[model samples]
Target: MTIRMQPDYRLSIAQIVPRTEAEGPGVRFALWFQGCPLRCPGCCNPEMLPFEGGTPMALGEIVRQMGQGLESHGIEGITLLGGEPLAHAPGAAALARAAREIGLSVMVFTGYTLEEARQMPDTAVAELLAHTDILVDGPYVREQPDSTRRWIGSTNQRVHFLSERYRADDPCWRQPNTLEIRLREGELAVNGFPARSAVGLWRRPPWRTPRDP
Candidate 1:
């Protein structure tokens, strides 16, 4: 008897920012994968914590949108920020591979430290790392803060360059430097904290919109 395995599709998404000045270097297209196990206090996107919160999208559709973002608006690369992307490792890996194939530099944001990720047994996590150029790893510790870090919150967390020093056999990437987190109004409002960066965001009404407003 043969066992047929289903291909891993793209995981559910909380949001997509097609053109964002923040997240990474250059204009980046960011995908916020849904579902997280870590129930960190004051998490910016607490809405993304529940596994069942968001709608699942097809991998091809995501890739297509990314291509459009690159061609039409000149987005330089893609960034994966998540409610724990490693939770849906297969889907994340598939997406990373797709992005790399198109010559888009990839960056990922995770709650897990580089050491913790190395210890995880999931095969897809390894695959995800294979295509990743940079990883901002570790849990958010609000207590430790440096005024100058870029794209991360605390001093304890590290920005690791995977392609430079990471290996499949041996785990643990080098701790490059501290990261900075710039917050938009929605993030601060949701997280219940003050934010450095402010942006105008549209809030959709809970009720259905009438044909004429």
Candidate 2:
């Protein structure tokens, strides 16, 4: 595959959380890209589904932010989530390369299965996969929601360790589901593979009581 580098690269990003423990192993920076081709049901971030509505950030700005996260928060690596990271393959590949250059491990979550991604004619997709240390692939299946696996939404999603940064034998990957809730400026944001009740609880108004006090 011919790997082409994108000069003056920019990514359509939904959000960038500087530090998060729930995204991957250890403390890590998380980037959620703006668009997705596969609008799978039960997607955790439906806001990321629209291809055109995110901030178009320069690649250098993103790298600089990652470096800041590493320095200020001692982040171990970066996790790329989406809409679908692979949908923006070239830019995603460039970002991953930049992250690796700074000695940070890269993990990616995608709706494309490994086989499907490998067969894509786009060299950018191949290049992005090449730079990924860990990849969680397969579309989210609402019927097969998974709570036992770490960093994946469904049982059908498979985790691939493309490099030595992490291991399949690691207990963290098989542990029961976990989540993190962040309350910022009176807004609540939940992260991780949370169960239905947890989501419901989060959605419930804080002032409301069981007895309607």
Candidate 3:
């Protein structure tokens, strides 16, 4: 599948962490795209379900921030989450390509299984997969929470090393998942996989623009 080129692409962003160790192996720039079709019961970010609200950000700005993450935090990669990355394939692909051009690895978490994604007619989905070094696939099954894998949400999800950039036996995969709480400019933001009991402790700051889902 060949993606249609759009040099002036933009993304509807739910959230963006310029540098976060909780998102993937090593520090990375993580993006949560706005909106998703799948209504997995107990979706972690319900605020992101609607397609309307979110910051409309230019692709170039996102790429710039990614480069800044590399220089300031020495990040090794970028992680694309949701809402649903496949739902925002065009911008995600553009971001993945920009990450690769800067010598950073690309990791994506998609609700669609690899087989399902491949079967889809979306050309940008194929392009995103082509540039992805790692893919965590499958819907988040709230009944089957994952405790064994560092970044996985549920046991139903599978990790695919789409490229040789990472391996199953990597020591990082064995580490425990962690949650990050950021208090910047009096805004409280939390991310990463946390224990079910800990989910209610952190509340989004009232002043946050574009909101978190």
Native-referenced Cα lDDT, model 3 = 0.82
lDDT of 3 by residue, 84-142 (tens): 99999988988998899999999999899999999988889999999999999999898
Which candidate leads in TM-score?
3
**TM-score of every candidate relative to the true structure:** 0.75, 0.86, 0.90
Query: After superposition, which runs of candidate 2 have C-alpha atoms over 4 Å from their true positions?
Result: 1-8, 174-176, 195-213
Per-residue lDDT tens digits for candidate 1, residues 1-213, read: 111123435468876766655666656777777799997665666667889977677787778778877887788778887688888777778878877778787888888988888788887788888878889888777676534465566677788878752342332222333222323433321110123112222222111221111
CA displacement after TM-score superposition, residue 154 of candidate 2 (Å): 0.6
List, residue by residue over 121-144, the lDDT tens digit for candidate 2. Answer: 888899888899999999988889
Q: Which ten residues in a row have the lowest lDDT in candidate 1?
A: 204-213
lDDT of 2: 0.77
Model 3, poorest ten-residue lDDT window?
Answer: 204-213
Evaluate residue 6 in candidate 3 and report its C-alpha lDDT on the 0 to 100 scale: 61
Candidate ranking under lDDT, highest first, comes to 3, 2, 1
